[model samples]
Target: MRNLASLLLLFLVLLAAGPLQAAPRRDFANQYQPRRTVEVDTRREGDSLRVYLRFPNRIAQRRRVPLRVMGWIDFDARRPLWQDTVRGAARRLRPDGDVDRLSFALPISRLVSGHALSVAFGDAEDAMGGDAAWLRLTPENLNRSFIFIDSLSRPLMRRYVRAREVFGVDAYAPGQTLNAYRYPLSSLAAAPPMATSNTLGQQPRTLGLQDSARFNADQLLRLPAGLYLLRLGNRGPSQGLLVEENRFPQLTSADELIAPLIYVSTSEERQKLFDAPDPKKAVDYFWLGVASDDQDKARQLIRQFYGRVVVANTIFSAHKAGWLTDRGMLYQILGAPETVYRSGNEERWVYRGYQSLNTIFVFRAKPSIFAPDNYELVRRPEHEFLWYAAVELWRKGLIAQPGR
Candidate 1:
C-alpha cells in the first residue's frame, strides 16, 4: 500500500511538463454501458485509491492505436478538484487474444467524505471523445471492515465472484464473532408501469444459515450462488457487509434468459416461454416473431436486447440480477439515457425526443443490508405511455445501439 501511494508523485511531473488539453464534457451514457475498449475498477485502501485498467484483446492487438488515460477527483459533475493524465504506453502491452491490465494508485489523504474519482480514455489523434468512468468513495467505507475476493487484493467492484470461488471477509473489529447469513438468488419481479410510492419499501427476504466464523484478520471461504451478509454480531439493524457470488454478467441459464422478456413480451408469450420444453428454442422463436420471421432481423434483435441484458448485469446487479431491477427494465427498453445527472443520493436520467411529457427518471439511492449501492426508481403513472412505446420499438426490432 505504501509503494502504491508513493506513485502519486508522478502527477507532479505531469504538472511541470505543461498544461495538458482538456476533453469536452458531453454525453456520459457510455459510462453505464459495457465498455468495448477497456474495463476499469477501483478500490480505496487506507489513504490511497487503487485503480485497475483491463484492456480487451482487440484493443491490445491494435499496437498502432495510441491510448491515453486521464483521471481527476470529481466533487461535482461540473468541475474537478484535481486532475492528471497517465500514459497507457508507460505500461507493458500484451499480445492479441489476452487480457492486459495496467494499475496505479492515487493518494486521497486530503479528501474527506464525498467525491468521485473520474477516469477518461482517449487518444492523441481525436482526443475529443470524452468517454469517462467514475468511482464514488467515502472515507468511512474505506476504513471500515469489508469483503473482497481472495484471489484479488481489491474490493469486489464487479459485484460477483464465480460460483464456488473463495472470498474473505476482512473484519475491522478483531476477535469479535462475525456471522455469515446467505440469501438465495432471487430474480426481481417486473417493474410496475406507474409510480406507486415515493420510496420502495424493502421486506425481509429468506436467509439461509451458514457456518459461523470468528472475526479474524480475514476469514476465507468458498461460497455458492447467493447473497452473504457479514455482520459483527448475531443481532443488529440488519446492516453489514453484503457479498454476491455469481458468474460474469452474461445470461447463460434458462431462467436468466426468460425473466427479462417480461418487458417486451405479453403475458401469454411469457407463459409459453416459461412452460416451453426447450428454453433456447423458445427464446429464438420469440425473437423470430418479433422480427416478423426475418432470420437476420431476428438475430439483430437478439443481440441488441440480450446485449443490454449483459450490460444491465454489469451496471445494476446488486441484491438481484440487474435486468430484473427497475432501472434495468427501462435501460433495456429505452437504451441509454440521453443524459445522466447525479446529485445527493439520487440520479436523474433524461431521455429527450420522446412524445410524452415525462423525459427524466429519478432513482433514489436506497442502500440495504443486501445491496449497499442499490437505487430504486421513482415510478409514476405518466411513465406507462412512454414505457409501452419503447417496448413497442424493441418488439419491432427497430431499436438502435445504446448511446447512439
Candidate 2:
C-alpha cells in the first residue's frame, strides 16, 4: 500500500510551487491545460511572418497567469535564423470580453529551404510538461492567397459549395471567390467577418455559413502566409487551409497527459501510476506492456495517439478542458471522425472501422453557464463494443480510421 507520508510531501511541494508551477488541479474548474485557455494562429508574409494569439476570459481574468510566449524559427542546419519572445496584457487586446488578441510579426527570409516556427509558453513548462506548439512555415507564396474562414453557417455554404444539408467537401465550392471579400480578418472588430471568394474552395458546413453575406463587412486581411485555424468567434473550430494541427509530439510527462488513459486504464494500472514516484515512467511502462515489449513501437503509438489528445485539448475546450467534454473524449480515443456534421445546435461524428462498419456518436449542443459551445454526448449501451474495440486497437498499438 502507498503510504500517506510520500503523498503529503508531494502535496506540500505542489502547494509551495504556487499556481504557475502547481500540479494540475483536479477541479477541472480552476485549472486547465494552456491549450484550453490560449489560442495561437500563425501568419506568413515573405521574410515577415506574423503570429496572432487569442486569450479568452479563462486566461484574461487571471492576471498572474503567464501571458508571454517565445518563438524560434528554424531555417539553418545548425541554429535558428531568428528567435523572439512576446509579452502583453489582456486589457490591451480588447475592451472587455470578445477574446483578447495579441499579434507578433517577424522578418523571415524566403531564402531558407526547410522552415518551421516553434513557439512555447514563457513559463510553467515543468507544471504541464509543455505549454508549447508550433507550425511549419512556407514561403513559396509571397502574398496571402489563401483565406481561412471559420464558424461559417450552413445556410450560407449552401449558396457557395451547395453542400445540400450534409457535412461534406465540395472541391469546386466558389464560396471563397464569392464570399471571402466580404469578411476581412480583424484583430479589433471582434465580430464582423470578412472572407474572399476563393476562401471556401472545398469544406462545407458551419464555416461555409452566409454570415459574411448577411453582415456585409468587407475588411480584408491579406491572407496570412501559412495554414491557420480561423475563429469567427463563439463557435466550433473550422479548418483553415483546410488545416491539420501541427503538434510537436515530444514525450514530456505522462502526468501532464493522463486524462486520455482514464477511459481505458485498468484499476491496477491506475493505482500503480498514482503510487509511482515518477508517474510518467509508470505510464510509459504501461504502454510498453501494451506494445508487447517493443520500445520503439510504444513510443510511436504513444506519440500518434496522444497527438490526438493534444489536438482535442487545443480545439474543443468548453467549460472545462476539451478532453473532459463528450466530443473531445471520443476524438482523443477514436481519432478524427470519418465525417463531422455540424449545425448551430448539434454536431454528429461518424466513424467507419474495419470492414467498413460504421458507428455514430452524436453531441447535442448544450450551452452552459461557463461556455456557450458546450455539448452533451448522446450515449448508448451499443457504444460498449465500439469503445472496447477502440481501446483494444490502442492497446495493440493500432488506430481507428476516422477522417480528414
CA-lDDT, candidates in order: 0.62, 0.46
Q: After best superposition, candidate 1 residue 274: deviation in angstroms? A: 2.3
* Model 2 weakest 10-residue run by lDDT: 154-163
lDDT (Cα, tens digit) per residue for candidate 2, span 105-199: 66554324334444434453312222234333433212232223323311111111111112222211233322221222111110001222353
The residue-by-residue lDDT of candidate 1 on 1-404, one tens digit each, is 87766676677777888888775444456557565435555545556655666655445545444444333343235545555555554454443246555566666574445666555344432222334445556543444344354555434445565566766654434465656566666655646647465434564465566544445435666665666666656652233333343455777777677878887778898888889999879999988888889999999888888898888777777677777787787788888777776676777788877653448888888876566667888888888788777777887777743343
- TM, every model: 0.71, 0.40
The TM-score, computed over Cα atoms with residue i paired to residue i, of candidate 2 is 0.40
